[model samples]
Target: MNTRPIAAGLFDEGASPRLRGGRHRQTGRFVFPCPQGGERDSYDEVRLASTGTLWSWTIQRFRPKSPPYTGPEAFEPFALGYVALAGQTIVEARLTGMAFDAIRIGMALRLTTLPFATDPDGTTVLIYAFEPDGDRAS
Candidate 1:
């Protein structure tokens, strides 16, 4: 899918966000899907669109939770935390494409896609990430 820039200097890995749950779900819930479906439980992960501020973050100086979490475990640490999207929802994602010291509360951030890992069958997993807004390096 073609990624596009959205409001407040945010860019998603897809064109436009797919609003899930209509009005039944809480406002600000977003699901990023490909032009089609059939992967990773039908792409049901909630992602941010345009307006989010970095509420807070924590540096993961150790390995992540479990299988499928394919980030650095030994040498390089990663950041994990929540971003406050508009409408009173906080979305948690991996922080990328910037230095740890550079991250601060209220910094601008947007959705990103990074190569997660390769499955035993080599299917490859692409995951959602968040980086400084408008910086494509993320």
Candidate 2:
């Protein structure tokens, strides 16, 4: 099936996925996907480092309020966490392939694209997920 991001610029299109962001031209502070406008309104697109340490996390067991969420009628609990990038922003994303009890602070993680859902038009929408950093061969 043809795949596409849940949103563009969330990650780079390449052999490996790299998170994309915007950096403030003057302050050098970064924002995920894009940057918030400043007084001068200067910003530049930049690829964010894919690896970061797991900061903190939680499990959302209930369906979130509608109007924004458009998932299936049946909801499944999932892991959500904050990852601290080195000298960069802390990103929040769904956790994958890790047991609930296995998550820990400072653990290594890598950004990845995971299957979200198939759209009405038959496009596979992929969302970002942070997984335990390691070789898949292992």
Best by lDDT: 2
Q: Clash number for every model?
A: 0, 0
Q: How accurate is candidate 2 locally (lDDT)?
A: 0.82
Q: Write the per-residue lDDT of candidate 2 for residues 20-97, one digit (tens) a residue.
A: 877888889987767544633677888888888899999999998876886666888889899889998998888998
Candidate 1, number of clashes = 0
Model 1 accuracy (lDDT, Cα): 0.56
Off by over 4 Å in 2: 13-15, 36-41, 135-138
Best by TM-score: 2
Residue runs of model 1 more than 4 Å from their true location after superposition: 1-48, 65-75, 135-138
| Candidate 1 weakest ten by summed lDDT | 17-26
lDDT of each: 0.56, 0.82
- For model 2 the local lDDT of residue 24 reads 84
